[model samples]
Target: MIFGNPGITYAATVEVEAESAILVDAETGKILFEKEADLTLPPASMTKMMTEYLVLEAIEEGEISWDTTTQISDYPYSISADPSFSGVGLTQNQDYTVRELYEAMAINSDNATTIALAELIAGSEGAFVKMMNKKAAELGLPDYQFVNSTGLSNSNLGENYPEGTEPNANNLLSARSAALLAYHLVNDYPEALEITSITTTEFDGQQIRNWNWMLPNMPGYLADYGYEGMDGLKTGWTDLAGYCFTGTAERDGQRFISVVMKTNSEEARFQETRKLLDYGFKQFEQKELFPAGYQIEGESEVPVAKGKEGTVEIEAAEDLTTPVKNGQEDMYEVKYNISKEHLDKDGNLTAPIKKGEKIGTVELVYNGEDNYKNLVTGKTQKTAVDLVTTSAVEKSNWFMLMVGGVGNFFSDIFTSAMDMVKGWF
Candidate 1:
């Protein structure tokens, strides 16, 4: 597919801790914008989000409970605080509720809490890491790895895992992977936002400030564009991962995800995240081109040989929506082709069709101008339709039967028999 779109680039702000970025709409999975979203980079504390995911999964499945408590072990990192402003004064025997640990893990970015939870969940951080990798595979995030639950820089601990001959980074992730992890966490678990969005909270009656300064302190990220429905996410930083933040916002039932990684400084990460989010919020508007369960245009209706009703309805499997910069709304042109080989001799649609099953495709031809066409693919979207056979029993009124097969039950019985004897023929 050829996309005749205007050219656009984010190279202007290309510098510092940011190695790559990607902007996508959560509601639509539409890639409104992106820049090297797939490039893998050190994730730092951002890896905790995946840990959050596993923990939540465990809790929801009754493997653990909110009230369930675990003992904090004396891991090297969990025990030693730089005497800096850190949460978790974790001692060897101290116990914490699963909910409390989750808060510590997400709200305060407590690496120690993460390691503890990971260790308890799988009996050891190493075994838990296997869980993390398994979960990543389940979620389809390929460019991520968790050697340890705590996302400490890899350069410090040399490779101790397999024979890769590389350093043993406690955890590593990409901008896209981070966003995906946070996306599922935020949307799937409302409790996560209830924790991460809080500026401050008490655990054992001590106030622990959220590491993600954007929540209450950073003015750079406090955009009044009505926040575009901004929601709570996490922030990350390290000598390796640099300054990174994953942000999400929703508006009018639409959600957008933006990932800014490797920013030079803490402030720079927020600034770049704001810039990327602004570009996304400004450049694209998601509009539905079609609706689900709606009849497919230019399709055939099934003919009934010995049934009460004559025909049934068929439609596209799912709704279709496209994201495009403003004024480019009308730029998408749909080109359709009919496949007679897949249809019966008559113009009526045949049965055995599933929802989202493909009857045909719609090729979106983009109006190439500016840089729009150059950046994204031209084919706008694909369309699926179901093939269902409908008929009515005995109808006294011919016109009414034409409308709904006698508008009665005799045909319904026939349909039941049809299903039963479907394989008979």
Candidate 2:
């Protein structure tokens, strides 16, 4: 049933009511879908995923520990006490473990706790934001910017503003870039999901609820909207940002990361995300295009002009497996393009060929246009591999070359006589 020319027929027309949205395969970094995904927009609480990532990185670096405790500063304490802000309420001067703070920040989307974790890692919220930006650069996220550990727009802080804080300050990320962030978070810190996935937990004996309702255990939404295998990431909302969620899910061994930003309501963000995820899961599949060391049965050998054996066998250096939609695996044709550098004007290799030299590329292409009606974009489904010599090929010695020439002359005559005999028969 494998076919090409991917169509959206199997996909339900999902109208995503969001400023930007993107779905990505976390493992392979393949973008499944996107809408206005490059537009810069408020990240909202989804910014906490980066904060959590940095915290986990620090923990892995042995710079911090789950059991390590830090005293609550006035900023975090005041933010926690402010009814307008989301927080795990903390008394001033109270010490809390890194683990508890992480729970508050990730599960509950507590601004104060997020700030605390940021400060603990970077000595100041601003410094931690710098680190966030640095990490974003390292991850190849070109358009992401973080102003604070929490995604709160500065306008929401009211009269309790910090001295040097700017109004309307907030983190920003494109939907595609946000998906990349989530990709790194899950791939690098599988343990962080344990904390982010918690729908309810007690901190200081108070039951805190996670804001991400898409989780299967999120109580009221479980039977309806709760997606199985939906674990973590973060959710966010502000008057300007509306409702945003960066969600990750795993099913049947495949993991997907989805980002929905600036939806009209909390429900729409999750619901639309579910549709996108469904389309991605149904329409695409992972398939191997080529296996390592695979040699074409009848076409394995390339003529070598000066080699001892007069020819050499080649193979692909490695395997290539990518997510292909519309059963492209069967319909897509494999083309091996041998490089001119490996051949002379007569179309035969002039050897002294090294064992592992690059000599060709393999490409996968469909016959017709893709879903977008584009020509399926050449080089999108291609990989250049070293066409290694299975055995080293050296130039023939003078006597060997003379003998080979004589042998080839007789061999050609004998082949002609056999062909004539076959023709008569």
Q: Which predicted model would earn the best TM-score?
A: 2
**Predicted candidate 1 versus true structure: per-residue lDDT over 286-342, tens digit per residue:** 776555544435543544322344554444445556676665655554444445554
lDDT of each residue in 1-425, candidate 2, tens digit only = 12544442334335678889987776777666778888999888888888999999999999999999998877777788888775778876688899999998888888888878887888877678779889988887757878778888766655534334566576788887788888888988999889888889999899998887888867764547788889987888888788989989888888888899999898898898888888778877777777878676777788999777778888777775666675445555455679887789888887688887778875555543443211112113343455566777898888988998999999999999999999997
Clashing residue pairs for model 2: none
Candidate 1, position 244, lDDT: 84
The TM-scores, one per candidate, come to: 0.72, 0.81
Best by lDDT: 2
What is the Å distance of residue 320 in model 2 from its true position? 3.1
> Which residues of candidate 2, in runs, are more than 4 Å off?
1-13, 157-165, 221-223, 292-299, 337-361, 366-368, 371-425
In terms of lDDT, model 1 sits at 0.63
